[model samples]
Target: MSSPAIAVENLNFSWQPDKKILSHCNLAVPQGEFWMLLGTNGSGKSTLLRILAGLLTADSGTVELIQPVGFVFQNPDHQLVMPTVGADVAFGLVSERLPTPIIQQRVAEALGAVGLSNLARRPIYALSGGQKQRVAIAGAIARHCEVLLLDEPTALLDGDTQLDLVKQVQHLVKSRGMTALWVTHRLDELDFCDGAFLLENGRVVDQGDPQILKHRLQTTTV
Candidate 1:
């Protein structure tokens, strides 16, 4: 069998050393599979995604990422640092010192792929929240990552922007054939995924197809 895109075994983490956020977590994500991480606020969903993205290391147990991961943070402000849209998207490739021509080609292709080709020369701050997120995603694609991770990716956007971002995510998974791990609290967004894991109190309390949990939650709430 092909190697999984990501694997975690008996993982545990704590920001304050003694206050654990993730406890004995075990997970494996196969290549090209999309997963939605559903959880209430402060349930460690973001923490787990951070660990998988190589931004944070678990304090105990094993966490392994088999594929290059591109992370789109919840807030685009943190990711958009360069002055221009093109510059921000080019940051990932430029750091590797690729030939200038190659970097330019990739930047153009990535921007064009996300429908932001027209905004390439525009200043980063001039773009709206959704546009910034798209640029961040374009940057990740330019890096040639096989897996993408997101944390509450649409929490700050308006309704239309949120829908556009969802379509963008679908394009990333279907067209690019990349594995995606989406973390979100919006149950409606869960339909955008095939499977989901429900988290509570920093633990995975339930998991399966998103539709199943939808029914379960509705039934219990009723």
Candidate 2:
């Protein structure tokens, strides 16, 4: 049997001892699938993404990630830490104790893939928000993760940058066969993916094609 890219079953979690946030969640993501996780605010989208990324522990459920996973957080500041764009992109690999030459090659390749080669030596803090987010993406890509989790990636981006990011995400899914789980409140972002899930109150209320889901979301909002 082919291993699922990610699987969650009867998952439950809570920040506080008495207050439960997620309740009896079950999901299965297959290899190379592009999935969009949609929800309203406070719907546990970010929390679920964190759980899949191995950052948060579930209270009492099975959460399995079959391969190395990369995460681009909602906040670019949280991901970009090094002095220069190149350095920041290389930070994760360096921590893994990769050889210096390999690290250098990976860093250059990652930056070039993100169209940030010229900005390799540029200070990370000086770049525009969109550029900083791209650097974060490059850093994640450098990890060569089989699964990529993005939490509200476009919330802080302008329209042009948001569209660009979606295109890049599509490219990654096609070329790398990387499974992506994107959590976002914006319905506009769902059009790029093949399937989407609507999450509300910590539960998956609907799941289907992007166009159908988009229409449902609009109707509910109206």
Candidate 3:
């Protein structure tokens, strides 16, 4: 069997010595699967994503990642820096000193994967929220990252756009056979995920099918 895409054991983290943001957290995501990290605000969802993406280090324990990760922040504006869609997507590769032809090919392929091939030259400021989000995703794909980490990616969009963006991302991830760790509070999004983990107070309290977990949450709330 293939190795898990992400593995965490006895993970612990804290911003301050007296307060913990995550405690004894453990998780494993198999390659080519989509999983949701579900939790309320301050539940350490974003913190977990940061650790997996190597943006933050755990104070203790282990994090084993089999492949490089690409992070998509909740705000597209925060990830985008170039004026045009194509330029932004190529920014990361340019720093690698890759041949011009290779960089151009990668940029084209990434934009095509996100269904933004026609807007490659469009100005970023003129794009809609959904379009901007797609641009951000294209940048990640250009990097050829094996794992995608998303933190509340749809939080800033309208309801319709949020669903559409999620569907688009789902299709892209499956087609590329990439592992995904999506952090979301919207329960409806869980229907499309292969598995889910529920976090509360910085620890994982449950793990299983999305439907089963949703039912559990609903029954407990009533």
Cα error, residue 26 of model 3, in Å, equals 0.4
lDDT (10s digit) by residue, model 3, range 116-198: 99998899999999899889888889999888888999999999999998888788778999888899998899988889999
Candidate 1: clashing pairs of residues: none
C-alpha positional error of residue 139 in candidate 3 after TM-score superposition, expressed in Å: 0.9
lDDT of each: 0.85, 0.85, 0.91
TM-score to true structure, per model:
0.94, 0.94, 0.97
| Residue ranges of candidate 2 with Cα displaced over 4 Å | none
- In candidate 1, stretches whose alpha carbon ends up further than 4 angstroms from where it belongs are none
lDDT, model 2, position 3: 81
For residues 1-222, write the lDDT of model 2, one tens digit per residue: 688798888889898988767878777677888889988788888999999988888889898886788899888998788999989998888768988999988889888777889999999879987888789888878888888899888888899999898878878788778898888888888889978888777777788788999998899789
Deviation (Å) of 215 in candidate 1:
1.7
Number of residue pairs clashing in candidate 1, backbone atoms closer than 3 angstroms, sequence gap of 3 or more or interchain: 0
Pairs in clash, predicted candidate 2: none
